[model samples]
Structure formats: C-alpha cells, structure tokens
Target: MIHSQVNPDAAEALRGLCIGLTRQALLAFTAIVAMPLAAEAADGPGTTSTTGKTIALSNSYNGNSFRQVMVKDWQNVTAQEIAAKTIKGATVVSANSSVTEQASQIQNMILQGYNGIAVLAASSSALNGVVKSACAQGITVVSFAGIVTASCAWQVNYDWSSYGKQEIEYIAKRLNGHGNILEIRGIAGDSTDKDISDGVHAAMTAYPGLKIVGTVYGQWTSTVAQKEVSGILPSLPQVDAVVTQGGDGYGAAIAFQNSNRKVPIIIMGNRQDELAWWKQEHDKNGYETFAISATPSISQISFWVTQQILAGKTVPKKVIVPLLRVDQTNLDAYLRTIPPGGVANPPYPKDLVVKIIDANTNHSAMPPVPPPAP
Candidate 1:
C-alpha cells in the first residue's frame, strides 16, 4: 500500500539526503576523536598568561658572587616580564643570612599583598611557618638554590647531596682513591652545606684511603673562604686536593698559593674567576680538575615556575635543575660565554621552563642544557 504511488525522483532525493547526514555524522565523530590529541599537542603550562600577578624574591644571603648573580638574574628576568606585561611587579629582598630576618621579610611580603614569593631560604625548615602562612593565604611559594621544606611550597633545586658525592668521587678518581682533601664547607646552618657535606662523607666511605683532613666554613664567599682556609691550613697536613661548595674554590686556591705549599687540585665551582684561574694554571703547567655549580640563573627558573603557578598551570611540587659542569674539554666553551666574575649561568626562558615542567610531569629525562649564550 505504501509503495503504490512511490515517485522515483523523490525516493532518490531522500536517499541522497540520508547519505549526506551519514557523512556529516561520521565527520563529527572523527573530529571528536581528534580534539583531545590536538589540544594536548597545543596546550602546555606556559600557554596561559600571568598578565597581572606580582612576585617577590626573598633571598637569604647576598654575601657571595653566586647570590649576587642570582639576585641580578632574578631582577633582570622579572624586569623583562614586567616590561612585557606578563606580571605586574617584582621585588627582591635579602636577609643577612639570618632566618629571623628572612621570616620577618616574608611576613612583610604577605602584608604587602604579593601574589607569589620565591625564596632562597636561610634555613630550610625554619621558614616553614612563614611559608605555610603564605600558602594559607593562597600565595604561591617557590624555593630554589637554598630550598625550604614546606610541603605546600614548590622547590626547584639541584641534587646537592649528589653534587657533593660527585665531587668526592671525582677527587677519588683523580687521586687514585688516596689523598688528603680539604673540605671547604658553605654556610654553617644552610641545607645546601649540610647536604653536600653529608654526601661527601657518605662517598668517602667507599674509598677508605681518601680522607677529609680538614674542613672549614667558607661562608660561600671568596674572601671568607680565603680567610678561613688560611686560618686552618697551618694545623692540617699537606692537602692533596680541596673539595669546595661553589664560590670558594678560587679562595681556597689563593690560600694555598699564599703559603709555601704547591697548589693542589682544587675542584672549581664554575665561577668565572675560578675558571680563569684554572685556565691560567692549565696553560702554565697542565693543571686539570673538574668544576660544577648550581647556576645562579636557577633563580630565573624559580621565578618562571612561580609565574606559571599564578597562571593556573599544574606544575610538579619538585623540579630538579641540572648542575653546570666544566672540565678540560668544555672549560673554554663555558669561559668564552660567561661574563667576568659571573657564574656559568644560562638564562632560562619561559619555553625552557615549560619544557622542564613537562619533563618533570611525564617523569622523563630533562631536556639537555642549551648551548651557552654567545
């Protein structure tokens, strides 16, 4: 009965319409399937802009060349961001290596309505109370170089313990697992100092013939390191090598030079002065040694990480920056790029920061160090 008056043209038109609808539906399904992959490819932690946030740097000490460069890098990077309208403002404050003073400064920052605070803490655990208070008020906190232990705060740090262990291992190898080492420690209460010292002691156990015959607090300042090393050298036996936390190597070398003892193998911390001196010595008498340091530019990384958080990016709680290392092969390359008296620090742009974030998120190896700035 339904087919009694069927029109061929009408039936054909209806079939065409159904085919078009089916094709459209298939396309819609395909688009839906591709949407997520497309978004994942384009989206990243740095995609969002932090256009109006304000950040602050609460540095513990401004005593050493490293800290000076750290602060300068932070200021320079933040100034660029401010000029670009990425952030509203950035302020830097340094305490005299005093935890009490640093805590007071952070409290002032909270009162001043800063959106984020990047801390180079005076004491890792001592700042927990102030850091927690900032987090409670919804302020983002990121610590680097000298990190804090607050669970809510994010940390961008070198593996300092591993740094120390690596230092000792290098010395062990250089001296054939037998030598008297002068350990030039950093600030007395600082976590960086303790971690590196602990690593050194732990690694020393593996090489029974190697010994830390003397230890001095360098305060991580060349002048202080030189003074302390000079003060203690009289009491110790001949030191075959000096293992140092950065900013102290050149000082240790100076102390040895001032005395009658020959300049032993001093592990450099990548300060320009240290590298220059090493280069001089190498040219004169074939001196060879290893060098490593947590780059001062890491402050820039912390600042960007803070900005990302403020921009609503989901970043990991801990991001480890690789330490810069120089040896006979690459020493000239590093020296050629670094400014005199500056540490071997590369500027960490937002893209690099994002890459670091992504790597940490995916639990993958970090992207390789970019070529030194020309």
Candidate 2:
C-alpha cells in the first residue's frame, strides 16, 4: 500500500529497472533460473551464516493496516525462528515512506554488520544501489511485497502485474467488455503501484470496449480512499465497474453507497472489512467477485529466504509468490478466520516455506500452493 497523500501536481522520480516485463519475458526469466544451485555459487563471499547470526527487517512505511499486520507477522515469525535457534535475534527498523531515508537506514543496517536483511522496499528502484551495496558486503538481502530491482537482492513477491490483469479482466467480463470504470490507484510513484497500473492498462488495451473514466490516488488507505472517492462520485458518469489496488476497495464501495448511487461491481481487496461487505452484498444481490492481493505475510518469506541464503543454500534471485484468490466458495471460510480489519489470509506456513526453500534449492520442482495461505 502507498504511504503519501495524493498531490497530482508534484513531480516524482522513478527508480530501479522498474520497466514492465512482458508475459513471455516473465516466463523466460522464471524458467532460466530453474537449475540446481551450488552452495558456493549461492553464497557469495562472507555470506555464510554461523549458529546465531543477527538479522534485521527494514520496512518503509507503517501507516496502513497491511503494513501493521506485515510487521507483526515478521516479528512473530522471527521470534519463532529465534526460538528454534535459526538466528540469535532480530531487529525491525522502519522509516516514513521516504526512499532516501529507507536507503540510509539500510546502509546503517549494513554498517551495523547484520548478517542478513529482510526488506519491504519503499521504492522499487531507489533501493537498488543500497541493496547492491549490502549484498556486496555479504549481507544477504531478501526483498518482498514491494520488491527491489537490484540483481543482488533476492526478491520474493506475488506476480503483481498478473494480479492487475486478472482483476480487471474479472470486471471486464462482468461488464460484457464495455463500460465506464473508475480506477483508484495506490501511491503515485511506487514500483508496485506502477506494475499494477501497467497491468490494468494492458487489460484495457486487450478489452478495447472498457474505459477508465477517471483515476484517483487512494494512497492505499481506506479513509483516504473514501474521502477521495466521495469527492469525485458526483462527477463520475455511470461507472459500471471499479478497479483498485488492494486495501481501498471497501472505502470505494462505501463512497458509492453513501452517494445513493448504484454501486458498481468492485474487485475486492483481501482486507477483512472488504470481504465482510462482499459477503453481505453477495447475500443481498448475488454479488460475485474474487478477493486478491499480495499478502502481508510475504515478509515471512523474505525472512526465511534470507536465512536460507545466509545458510549457503542455493535460491532463485527472483522467487515469485503468486497472488492469493478467494472466491465465493471460500469466502465464508476466510471470513470465519479473519477478524475485522485483519488480512483474509494468514502467513505462509512453515511447511510451505520448507517446500519453497527445497524446491528453489534443488531447482527440480515448484512448491504446491505457492500463493499466500487462504
């Protein structure tokens, strides 16, 4: 989720090799990395771990529910690993959504000689230089959720581009391929934001009849999204569908309801509030939509990956975690477990993490249920 407020006039710098990759390119990239990794090749100089090496988690923002759950999950998982003697202890450091501040904090972590670093990058490209430096210093850097483009950084994230395409395709199908739509985007200059936006644009191109009538920066928070959407609803003309990056869909729905306008078909994010509303709406009008998002639990994968890397296990440079999807059949099940404002999914399980580590280390297979736990 994005951290800043919307300010359309402000110019922002884009970072990293954040260019969109074609489906063919994505497939090719994944396939080429499917070979067994040698221990020496996997661990660069000084990368090997001792019995109790210290590691740290670096997060860019702590503003949203997703990030809060993400940090909590990271801390819980790290504590479990510590109890099991995987590492001595762990520290978590976060900065207010500034790429420069994040970079500086990461540099400080490197200087502190943390054995490994698990990071949720603030900007896809801005942290490249710092991540590379950390890797060069033999600090295993595992980036997740919002990924970094540094080749030296190990990435663990869902196929965000695919997520956008699938969700938009969902709405397009519901609309019979023709309708005015509202696009509530996340932060303006963030990499994940860019990737998801690219995916949405790609879908629009594929379905020529579908059009984005307006776009509002939601900053990926519910209150902000509600306020922004409320202000714009009066002007939008018959929006047939709503597309949003996760975390703000509920707010959008609220805005529509409050405006006394017929709510458009909205692709729900995995937040509990959204899912609960989705359930209620489904019962009332047979509203049908799937829930999807890059899971907050991805931080655990990053942590585990860092441990694997530091342990000299061969791993893929890019380990893609697939988007979690919850449809009508499983919606109730998800709702049963998730409390209000909770993420619909739990952290990836220990068994799944083992599967990922083994599969990637051997390069002989892929994990079952690679998506976040539903």
Candidate 3:
C-alpha cells in the first residue's frame, strides 16, 4: 500500500480561514441583535410602535344627536385600529353630563391600565384633578368637544366662539342689521355654551338696532328648544330672526310654526332634521340661512392623536379642528350625506389626522374641509 504525504502548511491555512469566517458571522449577528426591531420602529427614528397600546374614551354626555354621533365615531375608528393590529384594544364609557360621574369613569380607566384616554369633559375645570392624575401616571389624555383645563392633557378643539359669532353676523346681514332677534343657547354651564354666548353677545354690540328680545336655553335638544321657545313666544313681540347655538334651530322654527307665528331666518346647527326643515322652507319660499357646528368626527381625530402620542410622536397640547359650515350654496349636498336623525359627521382618517398634527406643530392653519361628494 502506497501512503500519501499530508501538507501541514495547507492544513494551517484552511483552519485559519474557518476561524475568520466564524468571527465575521458572529459580528454580523451581534450588530443585527443590537439594532432596533421592526416591532419597535414607528413613524420615524426614535418613535416607538403603538401596536401594544390600548386606548379608552371617557365621554361626558350622550344626550344629544351630536354626542351620539361622536360616540359612534369613536367606536368605528377604534374598532378599525384594533382590527388592523395598530392598537391592542379600546373601550368607551359615557356619563350623563355629570362631572363627578365622568371623573369616576376616568379614574376607572386609569386603574384599568389604559395607555390613553380621550375625554369629552362634563366640566371645563371639574375634571382637572383626575386628568392630572392620569398624566402623572404617564397616561395620555386628550380632551375634545368639551375640553378640560389640565395642562398635561391634549385638547382637540373647535372655534366655538367663532361659531356663535358667525350666526349673529349672518342674522345681522339677513335682516339688514335691524331685527328683533330671538337667541337660543345650549347647555347652561357648558364651556362651549359660554363661549358661544359670549361671542354672540360681543358681536351683537356692533349692530345697535339688532336687539335680543327673547332668550332660552335649548340644552342643544330640539324638543327642549321647541318647548322653551313656545313658552316664551307669547310674551314677546314678533321675532324677525333667531340666532342659535346649533341643535336648536329646527326646534325654534317648529316653535314658531306651532305658535302660528311666521318662521324667521333660523340659523341651523347642521343636524339632519334641521337641514331638512331648512330645505323644505327654502324650496317653498327661497328661505336662506347658514349652518355651522363642530363635527362629531372630532372623536376620530382625537383617537388618532392618542395613537400618535402612544407611538411616541410629539403633539401639541391644543389642536384646533375647524368647524363644519353648511351654506345655502351646498346645503343640499350636506343634507344628502347625513342620516335621518344624525349630525354632519365627516370621516377623520389617520392620514388626515397626521396632517392636522403637523400643521399644529408648525403653527399653520389646519386643513380645510373637503367638499361634499357629488
């Protein structure tokens, strides 16, 4: 048998190459392990994923159509996020315009370990203590529609004062700055009500001839508005026009009708029934007026804002959402989109919410409302 001679130098080279490859492989693996995982990356560098976060809504009131629509919007938006695995879960709890009850609800949410809570406040200041406590626990709080005064809570707000002023301005123009105006206010102690009433009273000073002959709190409910306005109509002179804080215009018109008085220029609050009544009157006699209100879809925006905060994005403490206005020019278009007994609720998808946040960050104007579908 012939024996083959082994090359010791070649053997040493092969062993060295094997060790080098092993070292390189280990280095690559370590680098990868040190990098951020896909699950933790979100929005941009330094941001964290919101996938594991859960959010909740603490609503103050569900008594009116606007509030009902707001709750429905929150459910629809949060449900979509949960189904997409963007958030772990979400829930909504509503109180009947009671500050104490709302505070209790928020306290429960905090104890339940929600990552975020969106509040439709019952009072501007009553819920501040609970809101601060949530913030101290590192939970994000977003207050919308009826905002709170907590410094740590983010607010998605509307220009309620502008809404009120617009109504009075339109009435003054329609009546040529001289009319007996009937004023319809909303919930008495609500921050929104106070803001709008202040704006209305402030704007009324510009036109000395325009006097507010009657005032009634409609509680932003049509039935309540109708009954209250009816009760006050007999004692007052003919009302030339009515300036309203939404959800009460159609009732004011009904009150006038029931009292056998002529219906004047009643500013609508963008409710479906109110729009329908306006359309009927418009068709019959070319009656014209304006409608404006904060869209209930602000709930959707609030949800996205919370999601962004959970994802480690820096958002402003106060984000202003524009009010929805329906004019005689596009009343029919808005009317067609609303349900039989619902408010005008536009959708607020995540992308639009991002734009709104970015705009607020840059101190620019928020995006304008899209025109109604044809």
TM-score of each: 0.79, 0.78, 0.81
Per-residue C-alpha lDDT of model 2 across residues 1-374, encoded as one tens digit per residue: 12233234433212111222343466567667643334425433224554578889999999877788888988998888888887898999988999999999999999998999998888889899999999898888888877888888888877678878988889888888999989999999877788898999987898899989889999888888999999998888999888889889899999999999998888888899999999999999998888778778888878877777777666778887657787788888888888776886567765576566665555645554433335
For each candidate, what is the lDDT? 0.87, 0.81, 0.86
lDDT of 1: 0.87
In the predicted model 3, the residue pairs found to clash are none
Q: Model 3: per-residue lDDT, tens digit, 1-374?
A: 01122224677656655665666677678768755443223323225788899999999989866678888999999898899999999999999889999999999999999999999898889999999999999999999878899899998998778877888898888889998988899888777789999999999999998999999999988999999999999999989988888888888999999999988889988789999999999999998988888788999999999998888787878888778888888888888888798777778888888777877776778787774885
Q: Count the backbone clashes (under 3 Å) in each candidate.
A: 0, 2, 0
Ranking by lDDT: 1, 3, 2
Whichever of 2 and 3 has more TM-score, that candidate is 3
User: After superposing candidate 3, which stretches have Cα over 4 Å from the reference?
Assistant: 1-48, 96-100
Candidate 1 deviates by what RMSD?
8.6
Candidate 1 residue runs with Cα over 4 Å from true position: 1-44, 96-104, 227-238, 371-374
Q: After aligning candidate 1 to the native by TM-score, how far in Å is the CA of 286 from where it should be?
A: 1.5
Give me the candidate number with maximum TM-score.
Answer: 3
lDDT (C-alpha) at residue 209 in model 3: 89
Taking all chains together, the TM-score of candidate 1 against the true structure is 0.79
Better of 1 and 2 by TM-score: 1
Greater-lDDT candidate between 1 and 3: 1
Per-residue error for 172 in candidate 1, Å, reads 2.6
